[model samples]
Target chain A: MAGLLRRDMLGVALTVAAIMLPVAGAQAADPIKVGVTITQSPPGSVVQGTQVKDGLEVAAKIINDAGGVDGRKIELVIEDTQGLPEKARAAVEKLATRDKVVAITGEHQSSAALAGIEVAHRYKIPYINTNGWSDVIREKGYPEVFNPGNYNSRVGAAAAATMKELGVKRVVSIAENTDYGIGLAKAIGEALKKIAPDVQYKYETLDRASKDFLPAILPMRANAPDAIINLMLPPAAYIMMNQLYEQGVAPSAKTWLYDGSGLADYPDFWQNVKEAGKGMLVFGLYHPKMAQPALGKQVGEAYTAKTKNEPNRLLFQAADSLFLIADAIKRAKSTDSGALIKALGETKYTGTRGEITFSKDKGYAFNQWLDVPYVTFQLTEVNQKVGDSALVSQAGQPLDPAKLWKPAK
Target chain B: MSGIDVDLAVNGLITGVFYALMAIGLSLIFGILKIVNFAHGEFYMVGAYAYTLIALALGVPVWIALPLAFVVGALLGWLTERTLMRPLYAGYTSWGLMRDEYAVIVTFGLSLFLINFVDKVIGPYAYRGPPLVETSRVVLGPVLISGHRLLAAGIAIAVIAVTAALIKWSFWGQQIRAVSQNRLGASLAGIDTAKASVIVFMLSGGLAAFAGALLSPVINASPDVGIFPAIKSYIIVVLGGMGSVPGAIIASLFLGVIESFGAVYISFQYRDAFGLILLMLFLLFRPQGLFGEKGREV
Candidate 1:
């Protein structure tokens, strides 16, 4: 009886070993999967998503061309977030659990990023934030999340500095009713208090979906402020600017139209706001005059060649996100999530933007690469490209107020 | 008060004129159909896209694009009536048996479908329609306004006036009024109630689209742009006494002025809330509205 049982156990063990051999061999040869969540449809900013997707694809191609990481191809598993938080959460869950991606990336909006990171945290997956600017995303202190994109605090400080340089006493911000908009508005107010204590700061939260902003802008006509800061995205932002211009409010000799939301780089910026965009000061994240890494130039050229449009800061940031993930995968030598997360923590790769390195500090600095390059540029003429615009400042340099031009009344 | 007060009032009135153009058609539809067409905003969206795309893509002049938008909207209205709305009125013997709940659900679904369809097909980027005039800004005494806005307002007034006149004296207008007064009685009197409903829908769709096309230069064309205007139209429809064209015009102007003044004096944040608060008060106190006649059921 004992001999017969031993023979049966040996036969079952041999069958299992035969099955495991092929599975193990296939696992070794399988591709490394990276998850990307982006808004490809309405209610979300599809423009931002399309740019990010292009940048990511370019970076992936670059990586794949030079012999994929450790003999395994980098596979991008994309899911559409539709710019909604609930949808983002579900996309992340599907990517993490169903697809078994090594890392999650390509979230553009802050609200969507905020929701996605929660699921990434649950599964201990590394999430490379593409363009979400809210500080709350960092404040969460999730170990698995990393932000290579711009932050609201940085933009707020830059805006406050510009306002102080311009010597504007009263400032009003027309912010979209969103986490990114409200956070940046508050950050700007706080920064202003520290630098220009006498400046009066206030912001009006407008619905992003609403077309009519005359009701909101008309009230400001009575006592237009010294400066008007736009902290909203396109379409809505363009409408608001036009209405303000039509009302003879901002961009006039009295009030300065300062854009901290980087509207000048948008492809439709000139087409939408022809007259209103002139004499506007823009807080730009990328300028052609600024020093660029070889990777950035390559991606920019590729992007321009494909879309026939000038490459913006988002393209560079998005490209760097994918590049960094690929670099980590190469360094880790495996597609295992644990290995990728550890390698991302020690990321030392130079991406299209700069030498990307995740910080060890907590809060907003957690896994964030500090000293991301930025510049301030002014749109001196209508339909002027970002490359042709006058660079007022570069990467922590003070903007020369004397170089700025004001409109003639 | 300073000169800014006069500027604000003029600007507010001009905006009120545009709102009235959108609301009057919705009011007419509610008067006859007795159901709020939630898809009313999509009609505006469709018109804006039609005018902008036709002018920009096909290189059609703004003059031609404006009327073309109206025709497109009218066609959409006709299609909506023939397909979705027919289920509500066709083969129904009694008004009590009419399925209003189903109409609301179907129209709401249509609104969602149209918005998503446009977003997917045209891409999500907002397109600013070409202006009628190249003039950017014009200063008239104390008031300053955009040339496009002034031109659009003038067109809106003319359209509203013509629409009002048509509804007042035209043969089809009287038939529509008769149907709204008593659907069963009008049917008994050989007034094809279904045909009257179809005409009302076409007029409603055309007016909403015209408003959208006129404002495309100022607002830009987007998928969800109609949502706000649609909400405003609903409020104006109720405040203006459901089916009363004159009442809608008055209510739209009143709401616009109130919003403009309240935004400045009170809080710009609560600008949208003022309309809702007024709507609540009207519903509580004057359910029949300013011009709606009280009705009794047998």
Candidate 2:
């Protein structure tokens, strides 16, 4: 009877061991899935979306080609947001619940990002914000949410400093009616009050979808400000610039055209706005002259090779987002949401931009890389690339007024 | 006022002219069919894409692409009438019993389908159609307008004039007018009512598409680019009276100038709101509009 019992126990142990072997092998071979949400269709900035997608793909290829994390491949499951808030919400929910993505990333629009993070927070998934600029995103205080992108306050402070250097007494900002635009516009107002107290400033909110902005721009013709700041994105920004130039408002001898939205990096910028972009001051996040980390150079080279287009700021931000997620997964050694979140919090990864580390402070500083670098530049000629443009100032540096160029009246 | 004010006024008027072109087609459709063509904007969108893709992608010249855009719009209009609109007047010869609700739903759905389809197929990036002239800017008195805009405006005016004349004196024009007035009576008088509706839809679609092609360089062609123009067209149709082309033209210019001046004087933030407010006032007080006939209930 003892011998028969021993045989049965041995058989049960063999069966258990056989089941565990395949499960372990499958774990080693399975790919880590990362979800990306972007506006691939109408009503969104497809230009920005395409750039983000390209950057993410390039980074994914680099990881996979390098044997991936722990010998497992990185697979991107992309969902098109169409730049709608409801679509973003649904997409994040679907990605987290059904696709079982380890991390959620690649949201460019602020409104869409705002909606997407809510779902990510609910699911306790790590969200790496790619390009949403609104400070309100970080202020939401979601532990799962992390930002490695430019912020509105950063651009606002830069614009204020540029305006002060240009000796502009009066300024006007034409902002699109969105969270990013309006938030930046307000931030500029606040920053101006602090840095240039005597400077007069105001902002006008324009519908992002509306083509006509003449009425808003025409009023400025009579009492043109010293500088007209653009807080809108393309193609609306392109239209506004054209109309402003046509009316001889900005980029003229009297008034300077300042683009706070960083419009100079877009590939279509020159094609749409020919002469309107000349002599325009831009709040740029990426410039060739600006100091970048070694990782940034590698990512830039990879992006240029893959897309055959100049690497812009969005590319670095998007690449860093994916790279950071992959790094956290590696550190965690598991795709569990709890473990990944803890690993992401302790990240000191040197991504494409800089040594990115999330802040522990509350509000807008929460989970944000507080010292993201930026620069201000000027487009001295038509169809000028950001690489060749005149770099007016570096991060936290003073703009040299002598180096600036203005149109002759 | 500064020289810039005059420039704004002239540019505003030019924009108004394009708006009139789009609005007139919508007005005509409403006049004849008594139903708003919600897909009117899609027709314009198609024309813009057709002109841009043909000129840029296929290496066709700008002039040839412009006319081709019109043809594309007309064909789309014809197809829309044959497939979707036929159900409205298919079995019923009588005018009063036409399925107006069905027409609205079909056109609205068609509009959605076209927008999404373009987004999926052509991609969503806005392509600025090549200009007729390569000249970037030309100074005309106080105004400094793009050379392409000046030339396009001239063509638009000529096309609008030709459309008005065709609708007034041509044989088909008279039949269309008769059908719009009293479809049953026109049918009894040996006029082919169905044929007239087809012609009107085609003309309307063609004109809107022509406007889209002409302005594509300035507006840039995208999947939902036609939405703004369609809204403005709806407002112009109501302001000019439901079916009057001349009324639409006058109203378009007036709205444009008012919006331009109001935006500057009141608040630039509410520039689009001015049109909506005007529309509301017109609906509340004068539903018949500036040139519309008073209701005569039978």
- TM-score for all models, in order of appearance: 0.93, 0.93
Model 2: per-residue Cα lDDT over A1-409, one tens digit each: 9999999999999999999999999989898999999988778888899989998998898899999998999999999998899999999999999999999999999999999999999999999999999999999999999998988888888899999999989999999999999999999999999999999999999999988787777668778999999999988998888878866888899999999887899988887788889999988889988888988898899988887899999999999999999999899998899999899999899987779999999977888898898888899999899999998888888998778999988
lDDT of 2 at B12: 73
lDDT of each residue in A253-354, candidate 1, tens digit only: 899999989889888788789889998999998999989889899999989888888999889998899888888777887666788889998988888888
DockQ of each: 0.62, 0.53
Cα error, candidate 2, residue A352 (Å): 1.1
After superposition, candidate 1 runs with Cα above 4 Å error: A1-22, A334-338, B293-298
Summarize candidate 1's per-residue lDDT along B174-256 as a digit string, tens digits.
99999888888899999999999999999999989988899899988888878878999999888878888899999999998
* Model 1 alpha-carbon miss at residue A64, Å: 3.6
Q: Model 2, residue B147: what's the lDDT?
A: 86
Chain B TM-score (each prediction, in order): 0.98, 0.97
Q: TM-score of model 1 relative to the true fold? A: 0.93
Clashing pairs in 1: none
**lDDT minimum window of 10 residues, candidate 1 chain B:** B289-298
